[model samples]
Target: MGSLEEDELVRMVRDFIESESPSPTNSSSSNCLALSHRTQYLILQDVLTGETSSEAKVLKHVLKHMKGRRDTKRSTSLRNWLVKNLKIDGLRASLCQTSWSTSLGCPAGEYEFIEVINEGENGRTERLIVDIDFRSQFELARPTQYYREMIDSVPVIFVGNEDRLCKIISLLCTAAKQSLKQKGLHVPPWRTTSYMQSKWLSGSRKELENPRNDYTGSAEIGNWVPPMVKPRKMDLPSASSALSCQFSNMSLNCCNV
Candidate 1:
């Protein structure tokens, strides 16, 4: 999207958020939701560009190894593989499941994503949210070319701090609502900002131990080896599956973010 169009989209999102915010002072909330065009550009840049940050390094390593891996077709499988391999590389990685109760017309739902905890200097710790298929989360049904271009800029794999992730979620959810409205479609509750925020911001953490046995693996990137472990059964229902089952009549695409 061009700079002028990008600015207009941001303004539209900002206005939508402020209108929905319960607080009388919309400016305060608007300020919080305000993500400049440059900031949005940098989100993709941070993921694509080489960076020395620990999180960036880990993201790069994971992406490199994940390339051409046929076993990671599903989001859950991809996250599990990443956690196991990241732990082998001496990083504290785990699977996080976030679920929220029905509220404000949104249905109850659960989501799964990967989380990596970084223990920094002086005992400081940072938690990063890693969504392997991030861009798919914001995809709308029959989106306009303008909206499609905006979403295309989102990185496929998103690794960032909570604040950064929240901002992105807010921006995308608002844009999704606008796009749907333009198409004369009802914005499903699952696509709302509150629901999207619940995906990453709220959940329980499940840490899987590295498998004792090691298996050799090869890919175009290099000889990437991930431990061989039995596929553990998770009783929790993924948000996509749950929503699809619940809203079978609704002609909406289920996004497993």
Candidate 2:
């Protein structure tokens, strides 16, 4: 599909929003207004880049309504359409492809898709593997291992559907976490690239507010106290005895002199 002009894309998205979800009397013109500013910007960016196709639109709509266990015929139809038509092995090259060193996939938004290729039998048979790679949200590795582990366990799923896409993402995360755990490395909640340490905040505040969940104790100095020492007491003669001894000594000294 040809890329759309900014204004035309906005109008089409607004129309789609109005048709899909109409707001109440007191609400805004459409439910799209309720989306985050970043999301709105991404929508515009995708549209302008010609990435906002019917499949993408349907996935976005389904994701927006995934709060509860709610299901609808429209969503089911979209999912069915994707499962029936989309081929997992040979997808559009623009979407995902493996290269000499790097494998480029979908845009790295909340998550990204990756295509891993493995050659077997002297490159006679090629294995086209698809896996989810958390981008800015989290980190993932060993795409080939994850694909092999997941392919036999889970049934074939059309990732064009938001629900299935999310499932695939979560599955990959779980596998990655398990792998890390097996290696005695704890997987953090947020990606390592994200800024968790800041100089502005105190050490204690930084640890507590860290999303990694690895921080448990405060980084602030503890209320430590030094060990106390008791003074040693020395016994002294009485004042009267000391006076008598001094007088005796004086008398002895005079006689000696």
Candidate 3:
């Protein structure tokens, strides 16, 4: 992620904390200090932006806040907020909508997102299950091997690990790219270059290809793919040419979830 992106993420964290946490001046002992909330926001910013090498600060922050709470309540709450507030919901919703890249258009492996809720000694724990059927979606020559065996073999990541969830998404997106590459197919040129006209280009293909961007902008600021606009007749050829140049120069850096 670029510096611009990191700042945007930090600002988002601030907004959430400010909105949810009680004001310190209210004098309610049960209410956490606003300063403490700010500190935690900074810690999360560092963790997400890779400014901090050690997650010890984050661990300490969680432990301190969750002292009497049972079974990692702070972690669970944070994880839930991330899942619900972030663009994860939007991405899942996209599955219900029609896309130009579906079946006849050389779609990637089909994925089903399932949520598992379980009762545990601690409380209720939730896990996200991603079932990708590469064979059917990509029309593979050997269906059973990868779909029935390999893709299913990848472990379902629990909801708490945002980083792990990102990896899982990146893997899925990579599979999509690979399928497109193998078939010698490409997404429409206009879809790829529309971001540039909106002054939203991040100068990296990683930003362009991030699946999170396929949803709303806040999902990933630097990588957010802008909503498309109708271009004028004269701008059509230039935009098309620019998209072609980008595709030709694109690197295999598909991990920006």
Candidate 4:
């Protein structure tokens, strides 16, 4: 099994490179193919996260393939080939909202924001429920893969200025560049932005603005809303008294009798 796996891996790499465009047919609309050692490292970072396999193991394989080359100045021609550019609106509410990346040992959820707190000098915190989408039971281990990790042993508590009090999780904005360097590939500094925009900062200013509701310059600070639950219908039980009755004849007051 191990030998077969190794052979399969080698063949795949060989085919991946051969498929690249070897020669250009036109200057304006050129059909060309090219890539570098560093590009593989960058892809490995994204693939490792989405997959369940160990990142180190996958990284090792990618590095092994990128070696034996003194490649330089990766062509930005691939930049024009990007298809289906997607930019998410952070302002929009998601069915599932998450504070920390699930793999980083944080809550897994699509929970509604209970409230956004802003603490100016002290910091920020977000108070939310583990399973408050509709009912508590719905947020169990099935969808979120919730474990003891979800509950958070230490409640991330903070009490200070209400200006920057909302919970904000910072993420790797340039993690890919570092990942490439670790695997022995050096890309130019300018190419950093082209590789990938940090996912966290892609949202708009209002969406990214200190999750804190505090706005020293604007009136929106006071306009912050409190949770408002919608009204629901309920069934009323019919009047029935087997033990005691208002009627004198039917009344059976066994205890008081």
Candidate 1 per-residue C-alpha lDDT over 1-257 given as tens digits, one digit per residue, 9 for 90 to 100: 89998687666555543334322112122442355444534442433342338668768767866776544454565566667777787888888787777876868888888888888666989888778877888887699765687788887787877655655665566566667888999988888777777777755345544444333344422565798999898799889989888786454445532
Q: Of models 1 and 4, which has the larger TM-score?
A: 1
Report the C-alpha lDDT of model 2 over 85-155, residue by residue, as the tens digit. Answer: 22232332112321121112212222113222333445543322222212222334433353334433432
Look at candidate 2 and give me any clashing residue pairs.
none
Which one wins by lDDT: 1 or 2?
A: 1
Q: Write the per-residue lDDT of candidate 4 for residues 88-201, one digit (tens) a residue.
A: 111111121223223222222222221222222345332211111111211122221112222222122211111111111101113323334555666443223311111111
What TM-scores do the predictions have?
A: 0.63, 0.20, 0.21, 0.15
Candidate 2: clashing residue pairs, number? 0
> What RMSD does each model have against the real structure?
20.0, 24.5, 28.8, 22.9
The residue-level lDDT of candidate 3 at 182 comes to 55
Which is superior by TM-score, 1 or 2?
A: 1
Show pairs that collide, candidate 1. Answer: none
C-alpha lDDT values of all predictions: 0.65, 0.34, 0.32, 0.25
Q: Give the range where candidate 1 is weakest over 10 consecutive residues by summed lDDT.
A: 20-29
The true-versus-predicted C-alpha distance at residue 156 of model 1, in Å, is: 1.1
In order of listing, the candidates' clash counts read: 0, 0, 0, 15
lDDT per residue for candidate 3 within 63-125, as digits (tens), equals 342334333222322333333432332422111111132232333221222222223346744
**Model 1 spans with C-alpha error above 4 angstroms:** 1-52, 70-72, 203-257
Candidate 3 residue-wise lDDT at 159: 26
* Winner by lDDT: 1
